[model samples]
Target: MIRHAVLAATCAMALFAGAHDGLNRWTQDAVLPPLLHETSVEVRARGGELLRAFPVEDGRWRLATRIADVDPTYIEALLAYEDKRFFQHRGVDARALIRASWQALWNGRIVSGGSTLTMQVARLLENGRTGSWSGKLRQMQLALALEQRLSKEEILTLYLTHAPFGGNLEGVRAASYAYFGKGPKRLTPAQIALLVTLPQAPEARRPDRGARVAQAARDAALERLEEAGVFHSEATSAARRTAVSSSLKPFPATAFHTTERARLEQPEQAQILLTLDAGLQNRLESLAASHLNRLEPNVTIALMVADHTSGEILASVGSAAEIDDTARKAYIDMTRATRSPGSALKPLVYAMAFDLGLAHPETLIKDAPVRFGTYTPSNFDGQFRGEIKLREALQLSLNIPVVSLLERIGPERFMQRLERAGLQPQLQGSKAGLAVGLGGVGLSLHDLVTLYASFAQHGRAVTLSQYAPQPTSGQRVTASAAAWQVGEILSSAPLENAQLNHGIAFKTGTSYGYRDNWALGYDGRYVVGVWVGRADGTPMQQAFARSTAAPLLAQVFQYVAPQIAPLAPPPPETLIVSNAQLPQPLQRFETRDALKRADASRPDIVFPPSGARLAADPELPLILKLRGGTPPYAVFANGEIKALGLHSREASLGPMTQGFFELSVVDAEGRATRASIEIR
Candidate 1:
C-alpha cells in the first residue's frame, strides 16, 4: 500500500511538471520577447537625467534604462524579508509554498506569498500581481523560464529594475534618489529597509502618502532582517526608530543645456558621460541665479569654467533661467551665441604684439585719440593716458592703444591667427577693421574663453571639450614668453573688490551698445568666462563688464579657490623691467609723430623689394621694411598715408585690396622713395 501511494505521488509530480513546461512553451514566443525589450529609461549625465523618450503607450510609467547594481547589504535585507530561500529555489520555494498553503488552509484565506525573487520579477514584468489562480500559475512558469534563460544576477537586476516603488518611481535607484536625494549604493539602514518594503504594496506604503504605513512596512522588513541574522538586533531597532522621508526630493539638474545638446547630437545613445563636475556646476548655477535676481528682469547670464590643461568644460551655465516668461528667448544658449566681445580680444592682441616682437610689457604705447581713416578710436572713458606702458594700458583696458596695436598687427592678420588657433570671430563685413580691437566683431563666449585659456596654457590654444580629456598638444597661439608677459600684466590689474585677493589674470569687455558684458579669467589650473546681458539683444543700462561681469567672475574664482594654484612662473626670456629700462624701440610704442626727428636722408624699401611678386589675399598684410630711414619717417600706400611712426625701419601697410598700389616712404627731411607692388 505504501509503494502504491508513492507511485501515485510520483505520477502526479510528473503530470504537474509536464503542465508547467507546456504553459512556458506556449507563452515563450508570445510574451517573453516583449518583456525582454521594454522601453529604456532616459540617458543620464553625472547622476543627472539627460533625456527621457518613454513610449506614450506605456502609461507614462517610469522605467529604468539600466539597473544600478544593488548594495549587498540591501540584497541581503531584501532576500531576508521577501524570500528566505531565494538562492536555493529555482523560481518558487517549495517549503515556503507548503507553509503558506497550510496557513491559508487554517485561516480560511491567503496569508502570505511563496513567490521567490525571480517569481516576483516575472510578476513585475507582466505589470503587477493578478489575484486569479491562473495568473499565479502563469507567473510560476514564467519565473522558471526566466531562471533557465538568465543568470542569477540578471534575475535580480530585473527585479530591482522593474519593481514599482510608489507613484512614478520604479527601481531601487529611483526610489533612493527620490526619497533621499542620492543613489542607493551608500544607503542608510532605514533607507534600505524602506526600499525593500515598498514594492509589496507600493501605493499603500508610499511614504509621501502615508508616513505611518511606510514606517511600519520598513520596520516590518527590518524585523525580518533581524530575525534572519542579516542585520543585528540593535541596528534593526535603530532603523525602526528612524523616520522615513515623507517627501520626494528632486534629482540633480546640472548642465541641462549641455546634456540636451549631447542627446540631440547622439539621439540613439542611452547614456552620455560628460566631463562636467556636478558639484561645481551646481554652485555656478546657484551663483548665476542669485546674480540674475539682483539684475534687471529678462537679463540672462551665461558662464563656463574649464580646466586649462585638459580643456574640459568642467561647468557650464547656459543662461540664468533656462525657461521663463519674463526673459524672451531665455532658452538661447549664450555661450555659443555670436555677440560682440568688445575689449576682451585686446589681451590676445597684446600677446600677438609681444609674440611678433612689436612691443614688450614696459613698452610705452599711446592711449590718446587715434584715427584710422574715417574711424577714430578713443579710450573707454574718452580720456587718454597719453603715453602709458603697454602693460599698464592693457591692465587699464585702454581702447586706443589696442586699436593702434591691432593696426600694426593688421586686423586681417590678427583674425587669421585667431582662426588658426581655433577661434571664429564674426566680422561685420567681409573685411576686418581697427574697430575689431574694441568689440567691433562678434564672438561667442565659448571661443572667447578658449582664446583666453591659451594664456594659461603657455600660449597653446586648447580645444574646448564637453566630454572626456582632450589632447594636451594644441596649436601654438603665441610665444610662451609673450603669453607670460600678458599673464603677468593681467594678473596685476586691480580686482573690482581689491580685498579678495586671488591671483587671477583676467580681462573684461563691454560690447558695442552694451549688448554684452564679458569677463574672462584664469589661475594656474582653471579658466572661467562670464557673460551678462539681455537675451533679446536689448542693451542693459550701465551694464559694463567691470561693474557687472568682473565681480561675478571673482566670486566664481572664490568658489573654486581650493582647486587653483599659483600661475606658473614667467618664462626665462620674459622681460620684467621698468619703463626707463626698456630698449629704445621698446621704450615707446609710437606711431608716425611720436618718434624723434628723422635724419635728412632718403629711405629705401627693403621688402617686397620693388619688383617682388606678392599675393594679394586681403588676409595678408604687407610688412614693409625700410633701410637708411631716419628716426621718424612717413609711409604711404597707394598715395594714402598708411602710418606716421618711423622709429623702426618696418611698418605694417594693412591688407591691400587686390590691385596695383604704390608704396612710398617720406623722411622728415622731405627725401622720398617709392615702390610699385601688384596683388595677384
Candidate 2:
C-alpha cells in the first residue's frame, strides 16, 4: 500500500545528514534477506490448474507467483494506486518524501507515511517494526540497496511473496486462492483493490473476520483510483458494487495421494507439472468417495485412466476420501498395492496364443474339464460350453479355455511378454505357471492398466507416467495382428451401456477367495483400470468383478469419456476368417501335451503347409495329396466330410470355391493333420 503523506521536517533533515555520513556506508554493505525461500510445493495439471498444494516449512501458505502469471489489469491498477511513479523512481521517490514532509508541516495532525512499495518490501523481508525513525531509516537504506541489486520486477515479486494476508496466508497467490477460490491470474477491480490494500493492514481488514471494514477499505481505495483516473469510471463502479467473499476456500486436494507421492519423491521441487486433467481427476475422486459407505468398512475403491498413445496418466484416484476416516484405511494407496489380478490377465494370455500362431479368434476351443499336472481350473460359473470360438470363450470368461491356451504358450513366456507390455509382475511363485492364467500372480492396478494399454497401442508398450508424459517404448508385447485380434474379440464382450455408442474392450476378474475385484478396459486411445477391495486384503466372498468393479469401470468411462472413439482397424496381418474357413491346425485348440503325444504312428500333411497360396482353376477339382496316415483315411474340407473312409494315398476335394479352404484328413486312429491352401 502507498503512504502519501507522513513525515517530520526535522527528521527528514536529520535523515538527509545521516545518509551523507554513515547511511551511505550502510547501504553499500546492506545484507539482503534470503530471497530464495521455500514456497508451497504444488502439483499442477497440464493447463496449470492446481491439483494439490502443500504448506511451506513454517506451515504457511506462500505459493510462488511470477509477474506474467498475474493479470495485467491488476498490475496496472496496483502501480497507479500504490506507486504512481513505480517504474521511474529508482527505489525512494524524493518528490513524494518532500511532499509528505510539507503536508505534516501544513496539517495539524499526522497523515500517511511516505513509504514506497520498495520500502514496504524491505520491512516485510526483515520483519522490522516501522513506527520508529531508526526502523524507517533502515527500510529506506535497504530499499535503495535492493533497487541497486535487483530489477524492478524482482522487487515487485518479493513483495508479492512476502506480503502478509490474514491467517497464515503470506503471498498474493495464497490469498487469491483462499479468498477467491482461484489463482491471481484474473481478478476483478474490487478484488485487486482489496489485495493492494491488505498488505498494509492484513488482519484488521480480513474479509472473513470483518466484512464491513474490508468492504469500506476496498471501496475507499477504488474511489481514490477513480479520482486519479487510474481506472475507467465503469470499472470503478462495478468494483464498488462487487462483494468480497466473507469466507475462505480451502486449497484444492484433487489428486491428494498423487501429489503426496510426488512431493515425497522430490522434496526440493517447488512445483511439479503432471499429465492429468484437473476436471476429470476431480470427478473420479468424487466417484471414489461416493462408494466409501456403500461397501464393507475398510473397503477402498481405486481407479486410473491413461492415454495409450502417450502413456500419460490422465487421472488417478488412489483411494476414497481419507479425511479422518480411519475405518476405510484411506491412507493406503491401493492403485499401487500388489494384489491378485485373477481373470483380468486372461486377455494377455489369449493375445500371446495368437502371437505364437496357436489360435485365431474364430477358432473353436473345447472348454472341457482339463488338468495341468495337479492344477485343474474351472469356469466362474462352474459350467462349460462344450465347444466355442475363442471370442465367445473369452467373452464368457471360461477359465479352462484360457488355461488350456496358456498351457500351450507356456506361462514363462507369458510372464516375459508381460514385461514387454510394461508390467513387471511380482509373482508369488518363483516362476510363472498355468495357475498364473487365473491371477496367481501379484500385480497392481497400474500394472494391469499398462498391460491393457498395450493392446490399445497395437502391441507396442510404454510406461505410464504421472509426473510427465513418457515416450512410446515401441516394445512389442504381442504381434500387431494378435493385439488387434484380441481387442476385436474383447470389444464384443456384452458389457455395452446405453451411454456409449462405440464399444470398449474390457475384462473383469475376481481373485481366488475374492481377495480382489478388478476390471481393465480400453477404447481407441485410453485405458481404464478399476479395483475394489479392502486395503488389508480381507476376502469379500460375495464380491465379484462383473458386478462390482466392472460397473465402476463403466461408470468411469461414462464420467470421463462416455463417447469414446471406436477401436482402430484390425492390423494388416490380422486374419479375418470363420471357424470353418480357418487353417486346419488353427481351427482346433491343440494342447501342448497333445502335440507332445504325437508320434510317427500319427498322421501328417506333407503338402500345402499353411500360408501357401495356389494359382489353380476354381472350376477344376484340386488334388489334395497326403503322405503319412492310417490305411483307411477320412478326408474333410471345411469341417464337412469331403471324402471319408477312403483307403488311398491321396484324395481330390474342393472343386467349387476359389477362396481359401481348410483341408484335413483324419486317420482311423482319429489323429488328424490340416493344411490351408488358396486358389487364385
Best candidate, lDDT: 2
In candidate 1, which residue ranges exceed 4 Å CA deviation?
1-31, 34-68, 132-134, 210-213, 230-246, 322-330, 497-501, 575-583, 592-680
TM per candidate: 0.80, 0.86
Runs in model 2 lying further than 4 Å from the true structure: 1-11, 14-26, 101-109, 230-246, 290-298, 496-501, 558-562, 596-601, 606-680
Each candidate's lDDT (Cα)?
0.77, 0.82
Question: In model 1, which residue pairs have backbone atoms overlapping below 3 Å?
Answer: 41-65, 342-439, 591-645, 592-644, 592-645
- Tens-place lDDT per residue, model 1, 1-680, is 23323332333244256676674665464345245545443545444533223322454334453434557788888888888787787775666666665666667666665668987888788764545445666676677778777887788877777788988776776677678887677777888888988998999999999999999988988877777888888888888779987888765555667766777777675556777777788788888888877787788899999988888888888887855545447678888899988889899899999999888988887776767779887776878767788888888888888888887889888888788678888877989888888887878999989998889999998899887777755788899999988888888777775345568999999987888999999999999999999878998888788988999998898776665578999888887777666544566785543332232245667677654458877677889887765648898887788988677888888787777888888877777888777777
Model 2 scores a C-alpha lDDT of 0.82
Encode model 2's per-residue lDDT on 1-680: one tens digit a residue: 12323433444555566646585676788888877777889889988899888998789998888888788877777777678888888677766677666666678444545668898889888889766667777787788899989999999998788789888999898999999998899988888889878876899999999989899989988987787776788998988888887998989888777888888888778889898899899889888888767776678899999988788999999887675567767778888999999999999989988888889888888888888899988888899788888888888888999999988888888888887777878887687788888888889999999999989888888689997776767888888988888888888766634254447889999998888989999988889999999888889868888878887888888887748778999877778988777766787886877665553467766556565687776677777666555758888777888887887766777564667778788898888887767767
**lDDT agreement of model 1 with the native:** 0.77
